[model samples]
Each structure stands twice: as C-alpha cells, then as structure tokens.
Target: MRNRMFAVVALACILVGCGGCSTQGVARQFADELGEVALSAPPTGATYYLQVDNARVIEDAAGDVDMPYCYDLPAWSEDGAETSVVFRTARKLRDGAYLRFDAALLRGMISWEEVGYDELPDAVREVM
Candidate 1:
C-alpha cells in the first residue's frame, strides 16, 4: 500500500512539474494567435524579432548595483510586420545579436531571449 501511494505521488509531482514547460511549439502557437490581430489595435500579446544595437544604461543611485540596459528598437513580427518596442536587461546585450521578444502594448516587453540569426524570419533577416 505504501509503495502504491508513493508511486501515485511521484506521478502527480512529475505531471505538475512539467506543466510550466515552455516549448517552441507553444511559443509558435502564441505568436500565431497574436499575429492575427492588427498591430494598430491594443496589443494583446505577440512575438517580435530585433537585432541588438545601441542601449541606454539606467543607473541606480542608491548603491552600486547592476544597471539595466534599455533598448528602444525596431522589431518585426512573425509575418514580418514592423513596430517599435522598448525593453530592459541587467547586462548589455552583444552588438548585432538577434532576440525574440514576447510583448504587449501596455506591458512593453514581457520577456525576451537571444536567438541565432537563422531563427529570424526571412523578412526580418532581410532588413537586419
């Protein structure tokens, strides 16, 4: 009986832990859904691609800490739509590096990650 209980608990834990997994398929689906919406309208959410360029450093005067690097950059959507977005990071991003951003109108940039040049869509690659 104890062995069976342990097995069931282990299975439940594994299932719960995997719930937060973010796969490429999930990101693609999210981008696809958001792509259908017009960019002029209030952004629900969407994926954006951009190449790193200049950044503005925001200093924290309270103490010597990691200052956030901010970028107001031109971005492209999955379908090659264009827009501007502002995002921040603790460290300076490498010049010419490509990134994928999950963003909303009100929220600005929700999350972002560096990606290889090949991951960029054809439209973005042409301009970047």
Candidate 2:
C-alpha cells in the first residue's frame, strides 16, 4: 500500500512538472509569434517633409544599367524638427517637388513619396 502511494505521488509530481513546462512553451511560442508580427509590420517612425532639388548623379554604373541619382536634402517634421537626409533614387526627381519621408533613427530614410503642397503640415509649409 505504501509503495502504491509513493508511485502515485511520483506520477502526480512528474505530470505537474510537465504541465508547467508545457505552459512555458506555449508562452514562449506566443512571444515569438508576436515578435515576428512586429518585425513584419511597416515601420511606425517619424515622417519628415522636404522638397526635391538637383540630384548628384552617381557616375559609377554597372554595365549598361542606368546610374542612380542621389539627393541630400534638408527635411523637417510637423513639429519643426530639422535634419538632413541623403538617399538614392533610380531616376531624377522633379525639381521643386515636395516629398514625405519616412525615417528611422537606425535606418535613416526608410522610404519617400511625392506629396502635394497642401498635404504638408503648416510648420513645414511655412518654411518651404
């Protein structure tokens, strides 16, 4: 009878331990999935406004491929934050064209798209 009780208790303990491990594994899986979703989502970073100017055409070309045009322009945020951004484009941007820039601290400029003058914030419009 004693041996039987000991065996039952040991089995219960083992099962309890396994249950804890299973819970931990589930939590870990959830965390991993959340991290992946965060990484895959688009960057929610600062947006800056600027106007396209003359591009510094890249002279080096590989084979017959068209060289990229580089632009180093001053950018401003809605709150009047100022910064300089340098980026390359496959083709030249129209001079005096306004653009919205998505930027991250570590990644610099993430992307840019042309926007109408009216779309710019009042602070950005005032300066430009």
**Top-scoring candidate (TM-score):** 2
Candidate 1: pairs in clash: none
Model 2 backbone overlap count: 0
Residue 112 of model 2: what lDDT?
77
Worst 10 residues of 2 by lDDT: 33-42
Task: Single out the weakest 10-residue window by summed lDDT for candidate 1.
Answer: 32-41
- How many clashing residue pairs, candidate 1? 0
Overall local distance difference test of candidate 2: 0.67
Q: Per-residue lDDT of 12-106 in model 1, one digit per residue for the tens?
A: 99877875685445544544433322233256777878888854433343433553555567778887877766555677788888889787744
lDDT of 2 by residue, 37-82 (tens): 2222235767788888775434334622463565667778777666
For model 2, the superposed segments whose C-alpha errors exceed 4 Å read 1-44, 55-67
Error of 1 at 38 (Å): 12
Per-residue lDDT, model 1, residue 55, is 44
Question: Model 1: runs farther than 4 Å from truth?
Answer: 1-43, 55-67
